[model samples]
Target chain A: MATPTPTRQRRRGHDPESVLATAVGVFNERGYDGTSMEDLARALGVTKSAIYYHVPGKEQLLSRALDRALDGLFEMVADERASSGAAIERLEWVVRQSVRLLIDRLPYVTLLLRVRGNSGTELAALERRREFDRFISRLVTEAATEGSIRADVDPGLVTRLLFGSVNSITEWYQPARGASADDLADALLKMTFGGLRVDPAA
Target chain B: MATPTPTRQRRRGHDPESVLATAVGVFNERGYDGTSMEDLARALGVTKSAIYYHVPGKEQLLSRALDRALDGLFEMVADERASSGAAIERLEWVVRQSVRLLIDRLPYVTLLLRVRGNSGTELAALERRREFDRFISRLVTEAATEGSIRADVDPGLVTRLLFGSVNSITEWYQPARGASADDLADALLKMTFGGLRVDPAA
Candidate 1:
């Protein structure tokens, strides 16, 4: 017989990724603590035992989902646009790319945003989030030092406001109803940098 | 017999306001759904029946807490400083006052920010929050029209970014460790209005 195609290989129903996606939806809806392993299994139309075969428990699902969001963010920072441009340019690129990531990976980022250190899994996620913020704060500091942005406010404060504005997107953005990601990203870049950058005309 | 003073009347361990404050703490810590009446009573060192005497149930506690937050915000808007200034000035006043309220009632506002419409109480709070936003968005629109702020972005969008930056405060602000509320509010005003206002020098 011919070798099975990748699509045909998973005849059982759900793969690990697909399973995790469903778990994220349930987690976001009912909250992590409110949800149970059985809830995930029920939502996935599978037996609880079947779920255990793929992942240990609910916490693993949360960690994996948040990892996906953090990976996207870290990758954005590592991209050439974020890493090599003039400080302001780089900051703008990071902001724009972040808006794109937030919209594109709404559910995963939503789950990550809602983690409140209620458990070990959540506390670990919060740490990674801080690490990401620290990485970005360095960029803000560099931009300020380079005279591309204002120096009055603390770099760390700028990072908080910038990412806070970006993160708030997951709270209000509905893909079909609001402006497109590109449009919203453009607005974010304008709202943020428009304030941070010195007047070119002056 | 002498009528008991207000303080002496609460010999039953807690009053309605104190009970609600304790409820907000428990609700925020465990989440509204994750928390139970028994959990709340235990936290307050009281019986469930004692809690019920002051409040009907967990939902009432949530509604009461959110109402306190909402009342503070509306009061800020109603203040002469927030209501009578030029559009930009009024907006600034509202922003500064909001930061003060957030800090003054940190736990209450923190609980308010975390509501996700998981229940009727949350949904009602969410609606009131939107009303507050609508009130602010009008100020933004007025500012743009008065040539006080850039009009490139939608007023509603500006409102979201502005409040998003402000609302994110509850996430990371630790009063003792970070900038004072006055200093932070000043920075917020500078960061926001600096980008927004028309450059007089230019």
Candidate 2:
């Protein structure tokens, strides 16, 4: 039999990356439950099957997006832990890297932030996120012991405060025209570690 | 004709208050969009029309819930601003009141926290929320000028971090066995003012 012509590229019009980006936007707009495959299909002007071809399912799409951000965060932990520096310095380094990562992966990180984990995959992601938190908590504990940080501040509270400050960047930041991620990181760190008290009376 | 007997009084069923409590639960569990009128009705074992009797519509229900929390927050600002205290003291007072308000209105506050303002009502609520934020930011600016806080931190950033820390308490705090809101507030003040770093070296 004559060789059949090779099949046309299936997703030439539909790039997976752009599709995922659209999914994040929809998820961000409507939230997880509020959004559906149909909504995504409508936005893309394509059929559900096309989305299925790009992503196995909605959960997988969520997983993929979260995994990308989680990977960036986890890598920061590993890299910061390896770099040569005192505990506080290392903590500051981690803060800078984290802000950069959060800003760079804004959509993914925004989605990651909203994950409630009613699903098995999401529960796993939450576990991983918690593990990442614990890693930072341990660093704060060690830094406290080294007399690098104030001993009075509860380490757990400190951990939450730091992450909270970092995470708020996701709320107001727009990469289109504003401070770079590193600039934000520096600003956050300077304000946080340094304190807002400009004229401390001895 | 004989007066018609009230069916609700005759039947063993959910009351309006109980239904509202259940609606709040559903709202928190599934979020605003994730929830439906049917979901609330089903969760309460009532018909949708029954809900309408108590709460004209979903928008009214959300408004009632969100308004409760917003009222508590705005009350704090007004109460603190009017209280007998210095600038720093007023700020501290507001912080304490806010934490208490947060715990008292946990579900409503959670819903408030999750709002992305896709709806007109939510957008209005968000605008009011920003007005609250602006009020708090003013306190930060004045407090910094008064030497109540360190000036190294930007007032806007400090405001975000302080509230971020306070709001984060709702995420992990359980009223049964967790630290009281007051304790959380006290811890937040110290952390924000002095930070995690040990300052005795000075």
Highest lDDT scorer:
1
Instruction: Name the top TM-score candidate.
Output: 1
Model 1: CA > 4 A from native = A1-11, A53-56, A196-202, B1-13, B54-56, B196-202
Per-residue lDDT for B50-160 in model 2, tens only?
756555677777887888889888777767363556677787778788888888888889888878887988999999999999988888888878877766556777677
State which docking tier applies to candidate 1: acceptable
DockQ, every prediction: 0.40, 0.46
TM-score for the A chain of candidate 1: 0.87
Scored against the native two-chain complex, candidate 1 gets a DockQ of 0.40
The CA-based lDDT of model 2 is what?
Answer: 0.77
Pairs that collide in candidate 1 are none
**Model 1 residue B47 lDDT?**
63
| TM-score (all chains, Cα) for each model | 0.89, 0.88
User: How many angstroms is residue A43 displaced in model 1 relative to the true structure, after the best TM-score fit?
Assistant: 1.3
Span of ten consecutive residues with least summed lDDT in model 1 chain A = A193-202
Worst 10 residues of 1 chain B by lDDT: B193-202
